[model samples]
Target: MVKESKLLPRPEFQRRLVWSRDDKNHFLDSVLRGYPFPEIYFADGDVNLETGEGTQLLVDGLQRVSTLIQYFDGDDNLKLTSAPTYRALNEDEKKAFLQYDVAVRDLGGISKEEIIEVFKRLNATKYSLLDIEINNAVYAGALKTFCEQIAEKDFFRAHNIFNASDYKRMGDLRYVLSLVGTMVQGYFNRDDAFENLLDRYNDEFPMHAEISGRLQNIFDFIEECGFDPKTRAWKKADLFTLLIELDQVLHIRNERLQPSKVLEELTSFYDGVDSSGVNQGSVSSIYYKAALQASNDKINRVRRGAIIGGILLELSESEIREKLRVEGLA
Candidate 1:
């Protein structure tokens, strides 16, 4: 038979019963309504020989037990009122909890000197808990939260953009932020510029707000750029090129790209492309040269081609070609 002792909270535990009153009451109500709950695991404590009582404290599973006691005692306020009730009874109600049979395995036989070795071995096992490095590097806090918000919003549901499992993995907020940081490095002056950008958001900068608004516009514009859902491959170079061109058109400096004007310019560019067979391949090269006349460097010509193609697909080829010819791109 399992020995029953009142389990106390340990100081080293990361979390306490931090749930709000409503949250606690709702959880207790669900339990009182006969809703089944999963069994909780606890690490047993050592017994005090002089007192003949075990220093039983919780290692895990504090929340469920706390909820049960709160509701049973009619403490609707859901406060941590008193010590937990741990009775050694064979009653049906108790059986629902104790039937799992808590066995007290003696770790007392193991010397303190060998404890570290044992801990290392156990932790290195396949089912071991996640290390801090793995958690931080593979799954960062910001990326995780961002992904969760996206999933909760059902952003990809209509498009089936990402698989459910893929969404879960990508939800690591840190990784997503890192990728965005890499893309936006050109606009920031400092090495840790992304960190500063996050600080700006937290600080409520107006420019940051404008940039966020523009990002949403950009996402919408990409969809209009003939992104293939089945193949999952977009006209990558063209998308970047158009974004750069639109940035120039709007006179958006550094990272402060305005969404409203960017969208209007994108639509205008698309509406200007000609579709006549007289200038198919030449159309992309022509518009590209015209759009990039400010820099007009020969190195970026190949990249300009794809952007021109995207414009052709969206607009009339003749109009764009005529403008390019007038600008000396023909």
Candidate 2:
């Protein structure tokens, strides 16, 4: 009922909701069975300088709280052991559920730093969250939302990048953010591009929208090209480079290219990468020799981008050459 005091993750500190369906089912079932649960921790954030009010900021239980809210609000249909849904419960069952006492440990009069420390300690358990999830938790804005939108698109599915589970835990979003980040920086390994860009989303709202639009355009073109999703051409490194190289291809005012021809060139480029290069440890292997390790290594990124960029320029026809040259991708 306290909308103003809704459980808030420290701005830019928490991660996305990661509980799976089974996790939620088990949790609701446990609650229905009167099983004891962990204590929810909250910090009393000092008086609001602007609103002149104290607030209970949640330090933990983000996913747990979200699960219950979705279930009760009919936003999610959670199947339980004894009941198909919460609405199906008998009068006594509903009463019991309503009366269940959730334990909340209040860490009032604590500094914000102390609450964050407690959060870090609590989440450092066997069920630790992924770094991307923690990163996603920290910031929410046009950039984060835009990345999420692209992650769920059919482009990722057709390209075999990730599936529902990845989206559920925000892996796909993180992946897209990485790609966009790498593109924005034009160089990898210097910094966490996603983190830096996300922090700038609020101030760079228009720029965020511009970048998001470019991403959407890029993905749309990818669908048009229709490359084999299974090809090494679709690897994160390969795709990232190709995308940056063709950055001008999606411009509304730019000249267009032969989509099928582009796909053919992309396939050919990866084939060469698969066959080229010497034994260079992680980048070694006969089957995928030129392929960089699926990591953000600096040299790997530069080499991968250069190789793909070379092919992209070679494949571009006269129609889009003027634009590509202007963008310096030529």
On TM-score, the candidate that comes out on top is 2
lDDT of 2 at 242: 67
RMSD of each: 14.0, 6.3
Candidate 2 at residue 167, lDDT? 64
Best by lDDT: 2
Per-candidate TM equals 0.33, 0.73
lDDT of 1 by residue, 1-330 (tens): 122444654323213244556666565444534565544444445667899676444433455566655545545465532322335224775555434333332344343234334433443543333232123222334433342343443323555544443343332233234324434443222123434545434333344344445555555554555444532122222344554444433334333444444445445544443222324456633544434443223334323533443343344556655655565545
* Candidate 2's TM-score: 0.73
Clash count list over all predictions:
14, 5
Show the lowest summed lDDT stretch of 10 residues, model 1: 129-138
Per-candidate local distance difference test: 0.42, 0.65
Off by over 4 Å in 1: 1-97, 102-155, 170-175, 186-208, 234-330
lDDT of 2 by residue, 1-330 (tens): 334554554444555566767888888888889998899887776566898766667778777776766667666455444445768778998889879988999888787557656777798875576666655655667777777776777767866777566766677777777776765666666335666788887344565667777877787777788877677757765676667666744453265667887898778656655666656322123224324454465555655555455455563434343433454433
